[model samples]
Target: MNDGLNPAWLRAFVAVCDTGSFTRAAASLDLTQAAVSQQVQRLEAECGPLLIRRTRKASLTPAGVKVLAYARDMEEAHARLRLALADDDPHVGQISVASPGSIGLLLYPRLLALQAAHPGLSVSYRAAPTADIIAAVLASRAELGIVTHRPDDERLRTELFAHESLCLVVPAQMDDVSWPALVRLGYIDHPDGMDMGRRLLARVHPGQRIDQLPVRGFTNQIGAILDPVAHGIGFAVLPRFAVQAYPRRQAIRVVDTAPQVIDSLWLVTRAEWPLSASAAWALERLREHDWLAGADAPASWPAHDNG
Candidate 1:
């Protein structure tokens, strides 16, 4: 309710509630006891109410409790901003990106190589599912998010990060021929990745019999899906990046198919903000790795996916 917001006073107020003593709160804030008391008084006067009960254990009044919650949220936001600021390097600014587990492991090492070149450039990483990564970018919680595939939201600025061949991996012991027969063998599918596989299925073998699809064996972990495939519980689908090595003594084999198809990886970000220097470096490093794999490099970032 105060027209002149006192962020410092809010800090002091929360400190008092946490430490349960004004003297301790003043020490924490490096302010004198009288100054802490004065700030509390001013905050209360502005809000037309008392915030804390002055007793052995400091506690919030009904009004103080409400303000305290808001203060905590504000403090958290400020803390994030401070971290971002601290990441600044003379050559590049700090960037925070959210990505999926598989791609992040495969991709972030590429950025680490760039650290030698762009000493000032730095990157922070967070892991989440595709939908969660999109949400993070939308809320401006991260500068960018590297998702396995493009998000459903049309507003996101997305660019093709990479496209590597993918295959339907099944226990080597279970051999099958053609697309029609593969589905009948029961697949341990990933629910989050079902959409991409849906596209593949639609193209390769439209309307194949899925009666044996094994919807019961579903998981979000790529490794779990692979486990079933390895032990021959059912076939699993995974990107080539997840495979690490071919065959690897696992009783798994790529389904017999021609003209292999691959899943697309996308780097998504807000359309409005200029790409931070650190993020731009990371994006370029990702592109460099893609090119290393004999794929075309991205012409530019901050691109949109019409699909």
Candidate 2:
């Protein structure tokens, strides 16, 4: 028997069985009677003789009965595939997103809330570094990505999503932000700690480099980076969102600096592909909140460059 049986042949064979005659089946299928008969003949040629009687009314042999069942199953499966492909409803599908740990802390809950409100929607969130976030978006693993810096790839579309201030988190007891005070407090490093410290500290401690400070502790976990600081172990530089979400908010203080070091957060997606309805809806929801509202920025502060 032929393995690659044509669907049209199966459709015609099933229609003949339904109408009980090739002439009536041809009328229902909008084809000539000879064409319908030829289709059924082609089906039988592929699957062996399927009809035992060729009278005004059709009769199915045992083989024909089995073929009819298989054809019906194939038709139902094709219908289901069509329905799935046609489902473009924004509220009825999954949306995957990835971002840095600081933003993920804020975003994951918001997405969960969205899922709660719309029970039909499902969410997948990932806390990742900038490079990993970009890779996820490019590989189509994530429909949306939040990165501290804009990606340079031509395949990606990036827009300024929000601004995150680099904050100096010190023990709540420490009021002094003087260079000597920070040096005496030492440093608690994380994945982005050294780079963020260099940027923010450069403004406050003009001549001092981050390496000059002794490393008291290190943790790559965003939530736990401030644990040592809370215990009065050392100071660390972190994004304002991460600092705000910390459970022990009273144990740490964000030191007020002369000029705040703000990092631009970019929303990235595939440039060539249109976003799914659910992904677009989620993106809009994410943009609704001012992520920096209570981060201690001056009302008159102008937006900084992407640098």
- The TM-scores, one per candidate, come to 0.55, 0.73
Give the per-residue lDDT of model 2 (tens digit) for 1-307: 8666799999899999998998889999999999999999988877788887665788998889999999999999997576447658777677899998987787888889889999979899999888999999999999999887777899999887777788899999998878889899899999888988998898888889999999999998899999999999999999888988899999999888767877678899999978888889888876777754655346566444553
List the lowest-lDDT window of 10 residues for candidate 2.
296-305
Model 2, stretches more than 4 Å misplaced? 1-84, 290-292, 295-307
Q: Find the 10 residues in a row with the least total lDDT in model 1.
A: 295-304
CA RMSD of each candidate after superposition? 8.3, 6.1
lDDT of 2: 0.86
Task: Encode model 1's per-residue lDDT on 1-307: one tens digit a residue.
Answer: 6565599888888888888889999999999989998888888877656454656867777888888888899998898687566655335656678876666656566656666677766667787878888888989878888777667676688887665555667777776645655656666778544654554455556676444365537787654567767776776656656654333545677764443455566888888766765677566656654333632223442222324
Candidate 2 has a TM-score of: 0.73
How many angstroms is residue 63 displaced in model 1 relative to the true structure, after the best TM-score fit?
28
How many clashes (backbone atoms < 3 Å, residues ≥3 apart in a chain or on different chains) does model 2 have? 0
Over the full model, what C-alpha lDDT does candidate 1 score relative to the true structure?
0.67
The whole-model lDDT of each prediction reads 0.67, 0.86
